[model samples]
Target chain A: MNARGRIPGIRNQHQVLFYALSTCIWCKRTREFLEANNIAFDFVYVDLLSGTEREAVVEQVRRWNPSVSFPTLVIDGCRAIIGYRPEEIQEALGL
Target chain B: MSEIPREKVEALYQRLYEEAEASGYHLNPDKEFTLGLVESLLINEARYGYWACPCRLATGEKQKDLDIICPCDYRDADLLEWGACYCGLYVSEEVLRGERPLQSIPERRPPEGQRPQEQPARAPAVSVTELPLPVWRCRVCGYLCAREQPPAVCPICKAKRDRFERFL
Candidate 1:
């Protein structure tokens, strides 16, 4: 709940922002899981961004979760989940 | 990324296998997946002069990416705790024997802002001083220290003791 800025993909009071790394296996799995479940979400490949942009995004992620690990999921702009925990993501999404 | 020939990748896999064996380590039990990771590593090495971990992003600056080289600093601890490294390329004995399941490992590398500043290069010197303690080198960050034993964990790179190599 320490996150800043408005969450993306908001619909029906539900919003999801996925932060990932392009080559990360867990990130890919999380993406596939969200898509398969028909969940609307926005994602940014932290590794694919330009140096400055990547730093800024990483800083934002750190603010939300100090770990700043990949596949970080932000739901409703307040609830943040670190790593690809399917059960947690599912619960957070109310799926 | 340029395509690496299958034969070349296989050759690199063979070498990596032998090296792992020699180092008293084991590759992941999944052969196909391990081979795929090896191929990716080869591709990264081709793109970047050094063999960087395929799972992690590399800055293409050797000094900046020292901790992400093939045998990354966290490999030992990851294998010890999670039965596999983050990428699952290296595994613990239990995982290798199928006695344990590979699990996701937390990132041990500190964030960029928290990472220790790179040490400046040493100036040329001719004097040699003998020490009673053994010298150990951290393969990931290239940190070298002479002590009775290597640190339980690398101070700079956070690599475990197994990651250290005898310098002398």
Candidate 2:
């Protein structure tokens, strides 16, 4: 279950890592935005994880966002964008 | 995820809309967005045994997650400052008037370990004779009232009695 759910986009120009909670509307919107833009990404529903796996995932998210808020997008494993800022997301992906 | 019915979501939406209006608060006028948050509230309510804010992760313990509960402790401040609560379910006058663009706000809540403990509320320090009744403040909305006991439900935010703390 540690494997993330991957959405294949028309182009995988950059490795996009998405951390989200399935119950969060903002996360949903972020997902919709990425899909609409056809950006390939890997996402995990943090809430659905349990036990040590959840802790490991939380640490992963904490590295990018100490607040650990939802819809965290990590582009190329170096830059991370917090929240659903469409303009920032586009800029990060160089779209 | 529990399968919440459309009627369940609609009923709660109508109730919250009416209650918010009655208390001089405004629900986000984007009906679809508001209803999405409402539906998430139901999911959290069923999963956590309380209505945790959909945008924040809930630890599933009522005591630890109390402040992040729906209509969260930060709601009023967020509404006042950002024109919308972090989750955007509740909005401010500016948003209601279409003067402010509604969007996701920064998380005012600190990380789990960084959070400050709830304010100390063991006893009232005011002179009973001078004030007659103690002042109780809603930790969520900052509504204050002088009374023997806090109201069963907060008139302004509708947070339950336990959410009230003695202010004076």
Best by TM-score: 2
> Would candidate 2 be rated incorrect, acceptable, medium or high by CAPRI criteria?
medium
Worst 10 residues of 2 chain A by lDDT: A1-10
List runs of model 2 lying over 4 Å from the truth.
A1-4, B113-119, B122-130
Worst 10 residues of 2 chain B by lDDT: B113-122
lDDT tens digits by residue: candidate 2, A28-66: 899999999999999999888878998999999999998
Give the local distance difference test score of model 1. 0.72
Q: Model 1: per-residue lDDT, tens digit, B1-168?
A: 237788887898887788677667788867777877887787667767876776676777876777677778777777777888877888889998889976656778776755422534343243345656667788655679988899997766445665566665
Supply fnat for every model shown: 0.19, 0.69
lDDT scores of the candidates, listed in order: 0.72, 0.87
Per-residue lDDT of B59-152 in model 2, one digit per residue for the tens? 8888788888878888988998999999999999999999989998899997666542444545666556578778998889889999899999
Q: What's the TM-score of each model vs. the native?
A: 0.71, 0.93
DockQ of each candidate's interface versus the true one? 0.21, 0.62
